[model samples]
Target: MVNSKFEFTNIKCYCPVDKFCHVEYCYLKSVNRSYKYFSARSNIHQNPITNFTVNLALLKRYNGYKPFLYNFTVDGCKFLGNSKAANPVSKYFFEFFAPYMNANHKCPYDHDLIIEKLPASSMDYRLSKLLPFPEGDYLFNITWLIIGIPHGNIQIYGSLS
Candidate 1:
């Protein structure tokens, strides 16, 4: 078995439509060699999100960030209701952090979406065993769209070795 180590290097959040939604906080905290956490909070100030979509792009740092294995968009509501059928790749990635997020339910997200203190270890099996990836730096570029309009973006940067 290949012994792998995964760690989050940074997290960045941006809300283009600040009047309608905004990211309160997004950060990666490392307490020790074995303890690391990633957190992000986004507030929806407008009407409840009845419909939304997410564009996921996985990029690897070769000479620079280049498209890796996956790049697709999935309907957020559909994914929340039936993940496997919506998109297996997105489901796999979503499951990596779903346990720590409060936005797992179906459409109409009326409350603040929060992902707090998501331990990095939660992704060990998926990143190392289930879908083994080459040792390198990676970036997950995720864009949130409400009714086909861009609302926010979250970029998660990490490395596997």
Candidate 2:
């Protein structure tokens, strides 16, 4: 994919003065913790995906942690090709989310994003690998984390994991 045009130019998160903050730095302590355990587990010859799962969970928890800018964009795209500039909410989700969680890097409709409104307390879950271009060809299992967030935040998290 082409690089995302979306940019978050002036975020004021508390960073140590001497170093540049990389993406991993955004999740610093968790990233370090992930590294420590991952290194030990890898030494014991466990699959890398397990380590990844732990790290991803930590990253997910970052959602509950305070964000430097509650109002921000993360994905690299600014707008869907046919999206209206007048729609502020859509604009916010696409730009902030497309890269942060890496979903519908283009426009959701353009990418075939399948959306359904499930009941608040339902135990049923939906999983989709297609109707969304590149993601459409892949398979994913929906899980409790996907159901835990409010519907609005669910979309913010890209397709449910």
Candidate 3:
């Protein structure tokens, strides 16, 4: 797809240095993780069109620990194509998320990514595979982190087995 234009604001950053403060760095890293794990498990190993699951532990063991990023755009072609954007609170299931994820690099694995965490209280989760574009018509905020697993409806995605 050809490139387009955009504009956005309301950003906050947390990086090792100001040089690494770019949101795209963190956002793209997260996407590449999902692509490597989820896209590989679903498309290559299990049923790509329906429910397929993989242990998050396996992903960590295989792909290295995931670097959780603040909610940001991973797939921004829509904005790049038509100048529109998506919301963080919207429902997203990365079913057909391969094309967008594989756009940058190849994801090779036998299973799909299905995270399993202790279902914590006051926390509901849905896997995020897409984020808004990082170009014009964009808004960004970054934050630092400590080691804690993300909270979401992870159980509903796949079984613990």
Candidate 4:
């Protein structure tokens, strides 16, 4: 759920409903879902390669940092899931993939593979790469670990530095 305290621009998912489903649930169902393409809901004059910064936080309501995997497919990019924790160095792992993601499309594999420890750390070293413009727009899929608690925070940002 998005909080009212922050400002966010609402955008719709351009992909068909079947393709828009997050991959974590498929794992929960013990199924392998198909990966298809999607376009950004918002219009961009130029496809900006954003520096994606994903921040995973432990929900205050939970005992500790929760763990799981999330997955989704876009522009035929396939990101796999890895279990990890929330430590100082691990922030870069999330940043490595940040260049590929946006606010609407998150890693679908976040629910299945979760980190077991608090103050966890892991590194995903996806290099800075340009995403091909989709036939209509750009799309990419990501599979990453996330916490299990409902209240954990997620943040996305573009780096000017």
Candidate 5:
């Protein structure tokens, strides 16, 4: 649930009707839902290689962050879940994907991925590389992971390494 305190914009709904959006999000990729192609609801093709940063806490709430309509992809990215107790559900999701991510990755969350605020940021990509993540593969967007297989040439800027 989005807080009344912060006002967001351009919110689109891509969730299935059955599962509690989050859990459904997990099943959609593996279960092979209708979105075999890049669907708008999934926001798959909006890969801006965003120099803009992601709002991890907002992502935990609305599944994506939008202070305004702008680049919302996680190409060159950071993983806040590994260090702080922010999004527990999202943290669990990442943990499930850990083996494939990186061997040296450090998970931050102590509890079960609770939806809380961490000292998060937006557009802070310069120092992210030196922060230590997996070699070869960078912290690509969580949307990339959620969308599973890609059907077209998705230009992810951060994962260039």
Candidate 6:
């Protein structure tokens, strides 16, 4: 595979539990001609997160973003505990932001969850070689469910060429 280009076009974060949890900031930043950053911060105001699940959906731009390759839900706590044991497809996506995220340990997260300054290059290898995607627009729809209730939704938009 020749050097593929990956860029984050936009990011939108929505927290349903506004009083309990809210997104502080979410944006895509361009540092230079070839470097871009994806950053987000969410704050939990109530009890710490003990049990949670994440729903991941990959969509491609086919007549306005139709579901494509994969979609599944995994226990967030379990994945955090042993990422290797999680489904390979989900594990691959999780690994994309694992190094930049602060929620790496077990449950009962008391502090803010943040993914700060995650460069697009960090995911280039996975998108190019690990599980190659056709050159097109794509969206990663990720939802956070706390104890069965939807807490937040993060939609990440990007393109490969």
Error of 2 at 151 (Å): 11
Query: Which regions of candidate 3 are displaced past 4 Å?
Result: 1-85, 91-111, 122-161
Q: Best to worst by TM-score, what's the order?
A: 6, 1, 5, 2, 4, 3
Locate the minimum summed-lDDT window of 10 residues in model 1: 82-91
**For model 6, where is the 10-residue window of minimal lDDT?**
1-10
Candidate 1 residue 1 C-alpha distance from true site, Å: 3.8
Error of 2 at 115 (Å): 16
Quantify all predictions' global Cα lDDT against the true fold. Answer: 0.87, 0.21, 0.23, 0.24, 0.25, 0.87
Candidate 1 per-residue lDDT over residues 50-141, each given as its tens digit: 88999999999999999999999988998898876866778888988789999998888889989898887876668887888889999989
Report the candidate with higher TM-score, 3 versus 4. 4
Cα lDDT for residue 121, model 3? Answer: 15
RMSD of 4: 18.8
Residue-level lDDT of model 5, residues 1-161, one tens digit each, is: 31111111122223332221222112112113211111122222233322222222212212432232222433213543233453544443334333332322333212211211111111122223223222222222233223333222211112212
lDDT of 5: 0.25
Q: Give lDDT tens digits, candidate 2, residues 15-124.
A: 12122111121211122321210000001111111100000111122345222212322222333444465256434323322332323434321221222221211111
lDDT of 6 by residue, 35-145 (tens): 999999999887788899999999999799999978999998888888777788887888898899998888878998899988988766789777777889999999999
Q: How many backbone clashes does every candidate have?
A: 0, 7, 18, 27, 9, 0
Error of 2 at 62 (Å): 20
TM-score of each: 0.94, 0.20, 0.17, 0.18, 0.21, 0.94
